[model samples]
Target: MLINIMGFLVSYVFCLIITPLISKLALKLNAVDIPDHRKVHVKPMPRLGGLGVYLAFIIGLIVIGFPIMSNIQVILGATLIVILGILDDIYILKPYQKLIIQFVAALVVVYGHVSVDFLYLPFIGTVDLSVSIIPITVLWIIGITNSINLIDGLDGLASGISFIIVFVFVILAIINQQDTILMLSFVLLGSILGFLYHNFFPARIFLGDSGSLFLGFMVSVISLMGLYKTVTVSSLFLPVIILGLPLMDTFLAIFRRLKKHQSVMAPDKEHLHHQLIKFGLSHRKAVLLMYMLSATFGIVAIIFSKAILWGTLLFSLLVIFISHYFYNYNFNKIIHFLNRKYNKT
Candidate 1:
């Protein structure tokens, strides 16, 4: 454990110290994201910032891995995410193309044998899944990857929220006697902290697709592995609930887009965080608020880990309520105005 902590600290500092120069190079190369009328930021910022983060995470894992969690699956799964995300970052791959790559990566994680064992009935006991966990796991992996990707619209938001989530998982891993998750927690913690140095408001860089997809996949895979032995079917819902903020936000964004007869994959600045930003908050403030919400849901999930089924439903409902209330209160007019003014664009 001590060794793992040391590894994390080293890797974290290396990535943190190194990201600024790397970002400068990306800027020189014109690998920058120019903020548009819809984007939250008001300047041109270099992306591909995940390069440093991915390198730092791998280095930390390679140097000091926990007994269980830091296996070849982490290596392979992370590699795929980084590779696919880099492709998207550079060339803007089509949705279908990225989906295929993500599916293949999801399969690799599945082969790692991190699976949902059984569905827990409310009054009844656990029912082992007869069908394949393939579809379920794939959807989870892809969904989470996109959730984090979209939330990256705000500075430090994705990485900070992820850091908190990983921190909670680290604590949970310790309590559950699962040392494997420690290595992952260590690397993720280190990478996010390092990345945050550049990602904070008045940002120097954006994580681009590379970092978002990479961390998202890691979070989903690690969380599943941690709970595989403990959760039943109803308990399975906890993962979704634990990630309620991102998942719910993604779902509603897609729902809103579909209702407007727009492409679900279209890039827009109306994500949950962005909506909050449009409602008179600064970029940093909105990100911080979401970070608080993310941490709140995370803590709630940990507090109710034992009441798997009930916890899942209740938390999910809570997420829906908050999102609906916020959207209705803060965003109905904005969406209508945007639709009238910019939907054609």
Candidate 2:
């Protein structure tokens, strides 16, 4: 307990101290975001802020005397992710280039016993997935990594959402008595919160790819560590629920693009936050509303974790209803077009 608190505080304070320096470095290196037609910000802002959060997390781990060797693969993959992010931020790497590195990093961690080999389902006992573990793990890591990067549009939006998700993971850790997750969650919560101070409304710096990708990678890894092992049929949905907002945004983007015959990697102004903004909400209000939505998902995850058959059934019903309603209203044109195409067939 004491060590967790220490790690949290150390990471928080260090992030606060280091972020300003990183911001300056970003300026010096011309690592900044320029406002464009698809962007929301009005002025160029320094990036590479993720470097501060990364350094703070490392310092916190050192102070806590964490066993580096035990989690060497995870750390190594994260380091590679951060490096990839830094390079992308400075040089704007193509989507394929970034995807290649993400795959490599994910594979590196999978080689170190981080793969999901089995799942515990309600009434069905354990199902072995040894043969599919590598692909599943790689897909999850990359999916989450890009999901977070895709939602980094608004100020403090990604950071706050990530903070909420990690805090929920902290609660799950304490409930499951997972010491490593608890420690990692605390330090992460602290580092993100500290950065959010400078990142919130009218931000001084942007997370760029560096911060967003790193947060997404770490969160995905932590979820694998803490939640995957305890997954029951009901709890199997917990990770998706906890990361609901980002995952939803990610899937929606892909679906929308595919339906329009556009490239999945093409940029657009129809993200959830953008939709909220278009609906007349202020930037801050949109972000806060999304924060509330993510928190709601977190609560559902906690409930599902302790729930039984009936609870899982209710969750499934709720998901179906929400999906139908959201798709009907949010993407009416696409849905209508699909319906027409089906009828003709």
- Residue 116 alpha-carbon offset, candidate 2, angstroms: 1.7
lDDT of each: 0.79, 0.90
Error of 2 at 255 (Å): 0.7
What are the clash counts of all predictions, listed in order?
5, 0
lDDT of 1 by residue, 1-345 (tens): 797688779779988988988787777766778778778777787888887898888788667744435367657877988988877777778999988989988888788877655666666777776485888778878888888887888889888888988888887788787777777788779988988988888778889888899989888888777865664543655566578788978998999899999999988877888777666666666787788788888887676675556665686687679868875784657545544554356
Predicted structure 2, TM vs. truth: 0.93
Report the number of the highest-TM-score candidate.
Answer: 2
Provide the lDDT at 61 for model 1: 69
